[model samples]
Target chain A: MNLNATLLGELIAFVVFVLFCMKYVWPPLNGAIEARQKKIEDGLAASDEAEKELERVRKEAAVELNEAKSQAAEIIEQAKKRAALIVDEETTRGQQEREKIIAQGHSEIDSERNRVKEELRTQVATLAVVGAEKILEREINQDAHSDIVDKLVAEL
Target chain B: MAAEEVTLSSHIQHHLTNAKMCSTDAGLAFNKACADSGFWTWHVDTLAWSIGLGLLFLWIFRSAAKKSTTGVPGKFQCFIEMIVEFVGDNVRDTYHGKSALIAPLALTIFVWVFLMNLMDLIPVDFLPAFAGFVGETAFGMDSHDVYMKIVPTTDINMTAALALGVFFLMIGYSIKMKGIGGFIAELTLHPFSTKNKIGMIFLIPFNLLLETIALVAKPFSLALRLFGNLYAGELIFILIGAVGLMQLPLHFIWAAFHILVIVLQAFVFMMLTIVYLSMASSDNH
Candidate 1:
C-alpha cells in the first residue's frame, strides 16, 4: 500500500494509453459508421426516384397508346369516306358517258337514214320521168327541171 | 527435513507481499531486501502486471480499430465494437462536457482496470507457485523470497496512480473552464456566503477547508474503493486456499461473487471519473 515508483509507472502508462486510444481508435470507427449511414440513405432515395419514374413512364405509355388508337381509327374512317366519294364520282361519270354515246349513235343512224331516203327519191323521180317520155313520146331536160324534181322528191 | 516449511500466516503473508525492487546503499535489492526503502522503491509485480494488462488492452483494441470497416463486421470485430460502443454510450450519457479525451479516457479506464481485475479469477497460488519454482530452479534463489501478486488492482500503488491521474485532469479541467481566479473563488465562495461583506470575510477560511477536503476526497475514495474491493477479494481467496482440498466449493462461490465486484468496480471507477471531469468542465456551481 506504500506509495512508490509503481504509481509513477502506472500514471505514465495510463496517459500514454489514453492518448493512443484518442488519436487512433475513435475517429475511424465513427467515420465508417456515419459513411455507411449516408450510403444507405442515398440508396433508399435512389430507389424511391426509380419507383416514381416507373409510375410516370407507365402513365405516359398509357396516354400514347390511347392517342395512337384514336389516330388509327380516324385515318381508317377518312379512307372509307374517300373511297365512297370516289365510287360515287365514277358512277356519275360512267352514266353521263353511256348516255352521250347512245345519243351519238341515234344521230348517226338519222344521218344514214336521210342519206338513203334521198337516194331512193332520186331513183323514183328518174323512173317517173322515163315513163312520162315513153307515154308522150318526147324527152325531159334535167337542167331546166331541177326545181321541179326537188319538189317532186320532197313530196314523195 | 523439507527445505521449504510453509506456515498458515507466512503463506497468506507471502501471497499478499509484492515483488519489490529498489536501489539500496549496498547496491540492487529485491523483495525483503527493499523493506526499509522509502518512496523510491518499486513494486515490480504491480508495475509488471498493470503495464502488461494495459498493453494487452491497447493491443486488442488497436487491432480491432485498425481493421474496422463500415461493412459487415467479423465476430472479433463485433466483440471489440460492443465494448467501445458500451463505453461510448456511457460517456455520452454521463459526461456533459465536449472534451474529446473523456470518452477515450473512460474506455481506457474500464478496459484496463477490468483486465487487471480479471487476474483475480486465476487460482490463487498458481502463478506465484510457478514463479517461485522458476526462482528456485533457474536462478537458485529461495522459493519463498520470490513473490508475485498477479492481480494489479489489489495493489494500492496501481489504483492510486490511476486516481491521481484523474485527480490532475479534474484540476486542469476546472482551471481551464473556470480560470484560476474563478477556480479559487469557487473554492472560497458560497455554501456559506451572505449579503454581508464582513460575513463573507469571515466565511472564506471555513469554506476553503470544507472545499479542499471535499476536492481531495474524490480521488482518495476512488483509489481506496477499487483497492479495497480487489484486496479483500484476493485475501478471501488466499484464506480459502489455506483450507486445502475443502477450499474448492468455497473458492468457486467466492470467485463467482467476486466476478460481479470486478466488473462493477471497473464501471464505478469509469463513471465516477466521467462525472468528476464533467463537473470540472461545468460552471453550473
Candidate 2:
C-alpha cells in the first residue's frame, strides 16, 4: 500500500467522521440522558415533599384531636358543676318554702286557739252566774257579785 | 498439479498486494503496471474500503441520532446508545479535559476503527475473488490484475494515519494548554530535572533525547501495535485459506479468537488516543 495516500485518506475519514459525530450524534443522546436524570430528580423531590406534607397533616390532625378531647372534657366538667349547683339551689328553695308554710300554720293555730279560749271563758262566766243564783235563791249583793265576777274574769 | 500450485501461490500473493494506481509514462495504470514509484502511487482499495466504512459508520450513527428518544428506545437505537455510552464513559473516566471534541472523537475512532478491523473477519479470498470474477466477466479485463483487499486496518498506512492524527491533536492540546515555550521546556526537562545550572546543562540533551523518543514512540507504538495485531490476524487467515476444505475448523477457531483481537485492538486504539489527548491537555507536567 502507498503509505501517503492511505494516510491521507484515513486522516480525512477520521476527521469527517469525528466532525459528523460531534455535530449530530453526541449532543442529542447526551441531552436525552440529562433530561432523564433531571426528570428522575424532580420526581424524587416531589415524592419527598408529598411525604413531608403527609406527615405534617397527620401531626396537625393529632393536635386537633387532642384539643377537641380536652374541650369535650372541659364541657362535660362544666355541665356536671352546673347540674350540682342547680340541685343545691332547688333543695335550698324547697327547704325555705316548707319552713315558710310551717310558720304560717303555727300563726293560724295560735289565732284560732285564742278565739276559742275567749268563747269558752264567756260560757264559763255565764254558767258560774246561774250556779250562784240557785245557791243563794234570794236577792244577793249585786256589787259584791260583780266584784267576784270581775275577779274571776281577771283570772280566766 | 504443479502449475495449479504455482497459480495458487500467485493468487495469494496478488490478493495480498494493494490495488495500487499511479500515473505512468504511458498513462495511469493499476498495480505494478504503473511506472510511478515511491510516494506517487495510491492504494485505491484501502482508501475505498476505509472511507466507505467510515461513511457507513456515519450513516448508522446519524440515523440513530434522528431516531433517538428519551422514552423507550428501539433495538437499533439501543445498540447505538450502548456504543456511544461506552465510549463516553471511557472518555469521562480517562479524559480529564473539558473539550467538547474528546467524547465524539473517541466514539468515532472506536466505531470507525472497529468497522475497518471488522473487515478482517471477512474471508480474505472472497472479496478479491469476487472482484476478479466481476472484472473478468463483466469488464472483460485480466482477472489477475484486478487487485482488491477489503480490510483497511490491516494496511499499515491506515493505522499510522489514525495514530498520527491523535499525535497531532496531542501536540495541539499540549501547546494550547502549556504554551509553546512550556511545551518545548517540557520536552527538554521532564523525567529528569536538576535545579543547578551546571546540572541542567548536562541533563537537557539526555532528557530531550529520551523524552523525544518517548513522544514519538507514542504514535509509533500505537500504530504498530494495531497494525501488527490486525496484520498477524489477516496473515493467519491467509495461511489457513491455503489449506482448502481443511481451513473451515481452523478458520472458525482463528476467527473466534481474532474477534477478541479485533475488539481489543479497537479498544486499545481509542483508549490510547484518550490517554494521549488527556496527557496533552493536563497540567501535571
Which candidate leads the pack in lDDT? 1
C-alpha RMSD over true interface residues, model 2: 1.8
Each prediction's TM-score versus the true structure? 0.77, 0.75
Restricting to chain A, the TM-score for each candidate equals 0.50, 0.50
TM for chain B in all models? 0.98, 0.95
For candidate 2, what's the RMSD?
9.2
> Looking at candidate 1, what is the lDDT of residue B41?
86
In candidate 1, what are the lDDT values of residues A32-97, reduced to their tens digit? 656766888998999999999999999999999999999999999999999999999999999999
List, residue by residue over B1-285, the lDDT tens digit for candidate 1.
Answer: 117787899889899999999999889899888888888889898989888998898889888888888778789888988888888889989887687899889999999999999999999989999999999899999888899999999999999999999999999999999999989988998568888999998999999999999899999999999999999999999999999889999999999999999999999999999999998889887
Model 1: lDDT of residue A27: 66
What level of docking quality does candidate 2 show? Answer: acceptable
True contacts kept of each: 0.79, 0.73
True contacts kept of 2: 0.73
